[model samples]
Target: MASDAPAGEVSLLDSYSPDRPPVTAMRIDFSKTPLAPHYSPYFAMVIDSLLTPAECAAVIASAGSNWRDLKKGDSWRECEQILSVSPDWAKALSERLAPHLPDEIKVLKKGDVLSEHIAGPSNLRASQGTSKTVWRLRGADERLSFLRYRPGHHFKPHCDALYSPGDKEKSFLTCQIYLSDMPEGQQGGEGSGGETRFWPSRTGMGRQSKKSGGVEEDEQHTENESFLNIEPKIGRALVFQQRMLWHSGQEVKRGEKFTVRLDLMYNHHFEKPSK
Candidate 1:
């Protein structure tokens, strides 16, 4: 059963502290599917309370600076107007600011920064042989995109763009931070219905193929029995590999939803694992 701690408190990963027992946010058993056809059960988790309300508010304000009419892949540039969400954002502020902030407000300024590893389970960390507490990993993240979904807006079913088969610096995972949901005590976007849906295997989750070959998913599998629907909540983040997961963003029925989508890149070689 879900807890009622707050409007958007994450009950699972946040329960353990890093000091007393060194609890980790990454979980290996959040979702499993050996026959997923394309993805590995390697890591996919929805972490709650990763960000504070104040931090989310800052992100909301940051994204509001410039909201592009979200576009599909380049192959369907002509149909770019079809997507109802905001395209992307200006820049990633956390990586650029995390080093200078104090301990108290540091987490708020860099929630997504910590998210890089928290979303990626396994002892393999966001660092390479560093005893320091805040070691930025060598790879796994390159770009951070801010997605805004307003009333009647949404993304169709589709997976992320695949790298050049074996590009050492390709994006292998997609990380999303749910910046806003409902009202949450009068501090967020309005309306509702911005849930994310995913299909287990090659099910397509009942959605229709929109683009010819560039990977622009549409929301068409409304009645499919083989998909799972995940609702958006403030300060929650969803991470998964796009190589195998077929997903779509549900249309906002009433208000708006803000999400920070970061492209987790990959690097084959590393100095060594963190100590």
Candidate 2:
């Protein structure tokens, strides 16, 4: 979790190769968009066709043979494919998404004395030299993680951890781009079980009411409460606040599931500059 770049500056993808192909950006109107059915928005939304079918195919092929299996007990499991791409991918995405994102992502001052009850102790820090109450998207993380889930592969309910480097920068949002749909003619057709589902926070401070003993008891927790499910669709990107949302990659029972995950980094600044 290194600082990608200074605020308002572009980060060079140092770990990525510069030979990767370019990605196209889509214009979306997220204003007035509501969270799926009943959950609060929490800066979460889906953008369909963010990448073309050809682009998705190309991205999948780019992974080549780098696929590696990751399993940490029963809580997490997936096949990961890592790709190093030029900074253009993150630059284009950050630019297109900036206008739609909130103006200021808040962060506390570096030495501010706050109680332990604060939700994000690490995220509340300000820049090293100045009092910072605002943060802005610096760039996308260059290390792209392309995940593949075969039938029966799944991740249990969990919240995405933040990537904070030093006191100046951190990752606040995640962009999960679906690369391929379930193969045709499966049990429930293309969009069957491989879904990025979201549950309301269990601490009673979030949108929906708190629920207990559900996720811990049942691994998938499909029977406990109504959740927002974003099915696998080629080129669809699910972007949400990483800290506030509790999500899981439901078990894939049909065909293979392909997705590219990107972390969007934000950097705190000393002052709120005039727009």
Candidate 3:
């Protein structure tokens, strides 16, 4: 795949034109069939058939009353309140996922930042590694749980760690696993709207200066950041390095819209292990 395209392409959309054949036609399953290194460091994968219907139901059930707030005109205030149910569900998910989580996994949380409605589980922490945390809800950091949106409830171009305060630098990777499928007939079509976008992180993009240090000042240029949008897939997780990557959720158009989104942080000593 890399050889087919010239080097230094800035955006995925750059390599294709209306007259050219679709890029999907060039795809090769190098992982299953022996081939050269085609996967880019920023590549994302979709484990389409990972979760069963029963598991999906259990996850939705764990959401409780929070699932009721997803709709056309819901305010952020209402959505935030609805998101409060996550820690409770996350606790239940943690307990259920205990046996499957790696022995080194640990769930971490910050008491001051979390809402009173969702204080979260006390004894969870994740192991430090280069790879992103596993999608298993157990042994995951609950304080990092948050509800996201796009126009309608849109989140403009921005990265996750940039908004977080404590240990933000320690968060080497960020993960958002989809809890439900995309709504039908939405703009952008089947996988449009509600897409999670990732843009190449320019050098010195997120660096801060002590001379003029304030959250608002630091965030002044965030809107101009570039990114690539990814459509959500149920049971599939999106993970990537946080340093030079910009990402956000696209707006939803029609039909029901809801997702269970969380962030996974890691320390400097972490390394991703082989699958």
Candidate 4:
């Protein structure tokens, strides 16, 4: 895979326009905070017009059929609409844009969720000259998959990790490439509810307080944590250290919300042992 862009070209303060959103700096000061040791200064970017209108529409249509609905008051119960586009389309788009997608697109079903997808050639190509400087750290021979969400569907706050014993440490980075236009009439205001939010990890509260002060502690943690709520933009992708961050998809209250999320994770080729 290619390396990151040069320092001068990858500005932490510089902003892009029209096709790209203005770049913003995230606070790297983790020392003074009370967060868990895993917390890191993760980075992300938003790029507009990543795909053509026809491509976006095709992906959205495919996703619309696979949506799984959720019930009210559920913690992390949300509906997900998914579709594994043809390999040709996947490769074409990946080649033209995200070269990091795997050559094979695997369609997942109930009870078959895995940690991450391998980055394809398209992914590597897009990262070649980008600001985020860690794309080359990805492993080779990894698989890649895309996730979709529709209106009224919400993925509650949760970290993307292996729920099983052996596979927990294999997950590396959680990358999401936004595949739809941020609808104008959504929730937060004009472009409201379809925001993707990342909550800071919570750590160090007394063990006794953990059970007895559950609600209170959660509220307190929420207040102390720093978060990034990104507005959707076609072709824009965000990558972050998974184990160190807690993230979720905010509800899609208004307008049609469609997003194609991809994950780049480690496989058996992982170099270091899991902590």
RMSD of each: 12.5, 8.6, 16.3, 13.7
Model 3, residue 244: C-alpha shift (Å): 2.8
Order of the predicted models by TM-score, top scorer first:
2, 1, 4, 3
TM-score of each: 0.55, 0.67, 0.47, 0.52
- Residue 45's lDDT within candidate 4 is 36
Higher-lDDT candidate of 2 and 3: 2
Those runs of model 2 whose alpha carbons end farther than 4 Å from true positions after fitting are 1-41, 83-88, 92-131, 184-191, 204-222, 272-275
Weakest lDDT window of 10 consecutive positions for candidate 2: 208-217
Using lDDT as the measure, the top candidate is 2
True-structure lDDT of candidate 1:
0.48
Q: How accurate is candidate 3 locally (lDDT)?
A: 0.39
Residue-level lDDT tens digits of model 1 in 1-275: 11111122212222234432321244324235432443433346666666555667765554335445654454222111111122122123234222322242111111333333332332223344443123222323423456677766767667666343353344545667787875433336544677887754444433333542326533345464465567797776676655546677877776677777765544444443234
Q: Give the candidate order by descending lDDT.
A: 2, 1, 4, 3
* Candidate 4 lDDT score at position 202: 47
lDDT of 4: 0.42
Candidate 3, 1-275: lDDT as tens digits: 00111122122221224443321211112233211122232323333323334455555444344333333212311232134324444444444333432332233233222211111222113455444333222233453243434336554334444223344223333445566676566455554367775544433445443321211112333566444455676655554433334454566653334455544433322335455
- Once fitted onto the true fold, the runs of candidate 3 whose alpha carbons sit more than 4 angstroms away are 1-45, 66-139, 144-151, 162-170, 186-192, 202-227, 265-275
Model 1 misplacement above 4 A:
1-42, 71-142, 163-167, 183-191, 203-214, 217-222, 270-275
